[model samples]
Target: MKIHEICFSPTGGTKRVSSMLSRALTDETVEVDLTAREVDFGQVELSPEEVALIAVPSYSGRVPTVAAARLAAMHGNGARAVLLCVYGNRAYEDTLVELRDKASGAGFKVIAAVAAVAEHSIARQYAAGRPDAEDEAMLRSFAARIRRKIDDGGLDEPVIPGNRPYRKAAGAGIVPKATRACVKCGLCAAKCPVGAIDAKEPARVDKKRCISCMRCVAVCPHHARRVNRLLLALVGRMLKKACSQRKACELYL
Candidate 1:
């Protein structure tokens, strides 16, 4: 069986988690970057024998809208799917359920689900260095179980967590901006998943379209992209209680 790792990871946390799980899950694999702008997301086809590992980071307890759109547009053609939701130490409230629904709607047979923690995208102090050694072990174990189930021709539907009407998407108002250090290289605009940045003027951000996923900041060569420091600090402080304790990776098969 082949594996397709489809993910929308802006700051590398989700990509890291997906890659590790994909590695442990199957040998033959290809990555379908959800961030790519040129590809016709709906046209990517997968055979029934293929397994799609669909993952996205939780943005305020919901699927990132743009990512969800791309995923919903894809045609999975009865391929089995493993859904994953990665979050800051806070919570992955409705991300898994939303993803499962989208994958199933796109024609994949939903088989398993996972909720994993990684360093907070914005609130870095929480769950820092995670999907660390401990997470890796648990993910590998989950993969072993998944492999056995597949090997045994088990096609049971896995139950995932979340609500019907998902919580309103929050934490997206504060868009990052380029600093004086920005040399207008245009890389940020080129890499923006939603094409929210000004292509001709890289430093100017289109806030209406920006999802505050921090992809520009993560890819900026000059370290010039950032959001309001005070806002960031305030958010970090607010999350202190929910994120103070380390959360474990959860797998539902």
Candidate 2:
């Protein structure tokens, strides 16, 4: 069956995780970039005979609002989907469940789900080099199991994680700030998914439009952009207990 891999990854963490899983599942994969600016969601179409491996990063415990909107515009064409939520070492919270619901609503059968960890989007120290060798090995094994289940026609229910009423969407603060090293190259402004940065002055961020995805921070050539260092340090300390170990990638097929 054809495999459709759809994802929204700004800094490439989510894309990396999704690519690993896609490679394990099938060599015949079609990719859809949900992060493209001026995306025409109506252009995307899936076929009933295909299987879709849909992945997205958890932006503050929820799907990126813009990505969700783009996903909603597509017709699944009866494809069965493997919903994946890739996150920083932090918790995925309601993202997986929300994705499941969205995929189902788009007329795709929910056959499996996964929560994979990648380096923190804002703070790189956490989960660095992840979907690393260990994670790749685990994903390969999970893909084999998924293939077996499909072969057996096993469409049993899978337990997806999340509460019935999802936690409220996280606040949209934590805007990235540029350091003295910035060259005013405007790369961040050009690459921002939401036009949050001022194109003429790369260092100037439009806080109201920023989603705190940290795309600018990750893409900066000079490593000039960063979230508030004090805030990140405090957050890191508070979450240290919860972030002690990287969790194994799970599959529900």
Instruction: Note the clash tally of each candidate.
Output: 0, 0
Top-scoring candidate (TM-score):
1
Where model 2 places Cα greater than 4 Å from the true spot, the runs are 152-157
Best by lDDT: 1
Candidate 2: residue pairs that collide: none
What residue pairs clash in candidate 1, if any at all?
none
Cα-based TM-score, every candidate = 0.98, 0.93
Indicate the residue-level lDDT of 228 in model 2: 84
lDDT of 1 by residue, 176-207 (tens): 88899999989999999999999788877777
- Model 2, CA-based lDDT: 0.85
Single out the weakest 10-residue window by summed lDDT for candidate 1.
Answer: 168-177
